[model samples]
Target: MLSLLGLLCLLHGIWAAPGDLHSLCYDFTVIFKPVIQQWSCEVQGKVDEKSFLYYNCDIKEVKPSGLLGKEIQRTNTWEEQNEMLMDVIDVFKQQLPEVEPKNYTIRGPLTLQGRMSCQCEANGLSNGSWRFSFNGQIFLLFDSKKRKWTVVHSGARLMEKTWVNDRDVTEFFRKISVGDCRRWLENFLVHWDKMLETTGPPTVVPNAFHAKATTIGPRLWTLLVILTISVLLGT
Candidate 1:
């Protein structure tokens, strides 16, 4: 379960983004409990808050979506992105046992979800973060710039300590967040720019306009909202 402090922090983090920033994020979920069936993993990639690709571990394939997906597939980084996601699956499998809650008496279904994001501001500044949640409760956060982990829940303290002590794991997280993710974001931005140019600028409505916009909400916001509701429902 997420601590009160952790919930507040999560809410604050999601709403603190700048107006002119662009972000690329990868969200992955791993199922761990209800042990009668095979465990599964699913990954989704979003650019500028829209999903462009999906990877299912069972199928071991990357599936692209829409015109943006078609454009991304033509890039050199497409293969690299596939390989990186596969690596993420392997890392999650290896670390799941270590991060599992040891003292929780209630047992049913359990899940581990990770979201890694790279954000670029209009002025060319870039940064990234990695967040992990267990059973829909945010438990850990990694700041790429600081190369440090913050444990959001008390149950996750040991997991944080263990990961911090592992030099290889620490470096792997740092490299992926600050290096690979940022590079991939930059590459995707080039394609996104072209797509925007071809489509023209988005139509804007004045504040006085009462008509509802058709714009889709961000994937991160939807996920976080669902998680928050689940927490409130005590499910």
Candidate 2:
């Protein structure tokens, strides 16, 4: 039937959506806490094979991005963003020393949604936490079927990762690497990537509940029996 066909098509379409992200890199969301209570970042949107575009978010800043710098193990507070900013600029100056520290505001609250977790080197990993910054707090939500990458994870399959908890958020950074701007960013993002895994929305099949009126119903059953008898007699 047309109705059944349409229903099938709708389900198929939702399943076929394209966004399959690998857990390699990341994008970040930075906030000017307390007074402004706003956060934004430089990276956003679907990333190409080579690099990622900038995007931002307005979610809980439960943890800092670790994009600009690694958060040290201490009491967390809103006042630290500016200090983090200064430290980041110092690292930045070391790398591209010619670049002066200017107040660069975050772009906007983008929807670069992905798994929210961390992969620290202290877990007995080989490399130090200095390899994934260029792609910090930024990873794509990829669709395996279509091979397309998207920034937002609204309908896409996600890793069941949540940043709601402070413990999980703290793991996002280790060592507070002011080592170098580029390498430091990579280190933070790599751990974030490791934290990304398939936490699903749980796939389910579509089905029709009621196809038609049942003959077992009193009125319908009587009508069918009478019609059958009449047909038999007439025949």
Candidate 3:
């Protein structure tokens, strides 16, 4: 019974899709201080029922600067992403203090005009470049290497460039960018190129398993015991 309980606990924990948000629509409200402006960003995949593979990024209240109409820049180090996002937020708080919270919807990448650019390069080799635009409901992404426009929400390709979509693009993009459009664009291309070529979609082969086992073993045993005790007591 104890073993069964432990197994059940492990199963439950693992069944929650143990990663970030992928293939899901993400919406969040951010408070711009002082007068309190509520800015919301909604990122969803495709509008037309027929083509569900694409994505759109829309910001309400403000036109959003970094995402569109900025020169493309790349982060020198991966660790700097968080700092960059904080800077963007700080800028927003400083610039826009008191705008009423209103639902301003911008669709697709046609009417909206701006250039949010980022280049991913490593070892002095340029991997690719990315630009994002919004057309009321859809967020359009421009890929320099592919030299095409794609819906940012689509997953078949790593940002629509390669056949690798391991990480939750939306979640990762949000975390890395922190509502700053440029960093989001920059970080996506950076990680896509850095990981896709080297790591190649996380593996379970012994080497990978061994590394995870070392980190996860202690936690698993503790969880097993806790589950067993909790279940036996019917608590």
For this target, which candidate reaches the highest lDDT against the unseen true structure?
1
- In order, the Cα lDDT scores of the candidates are 0.72, 0.28, 0.31
By lDDT rank, best first, the candidates go 1, 3, 2
Candidate 1 to truth, TM? 0.75
The C-alpha local distance difference test score for the whole of candidate 3 amounts to 0.31
Candidate 2 structure quality by residue, lDDT tens digits, 80-99 = 43344334333322322111
The predicted structure with the larger lDDT, 1 or 2, is 1
Report the number of the highest-TM-score candidate: 1
In model 2, the worst 10-residue window by lDDT is 126-135
| Model 1 residue 30 CA deviation in Å | 0.9
Better of 1 and 3 by TM-score: 1
Sort all candidates by TM-score, best to worst: 1, 3, 2
lDDT (Cα, tens digit) per residue for candidate 3, span 1-235: 3333223333333322233111111122123322233442222111111111111224222221232111112334323533443333443233222222123332211122222233222221222333343232333454444444566544213223321232343333333322333333333332332323332333443454444543444345456545765776584
Taking all chains together, each candidate's TM-score versus the true structure is 0.75, 0.20, 0.22
Flag regions of model 2 displaced more than 4 Å. 1-82, 94-118, 121-127, 131-175, 178-235
Q: Return whichever of 2 and 3 wins on lDDT.
A: 3
Relative to the unseen true structure, what is the C-alpha lDDT of residue 220 in candidate 2, on a scale of 0 to 100? Answer: 46
Provide the RMSD of all predictions against the true structure, rounded to 1 decimal. 13.5, 21.8, 18.7
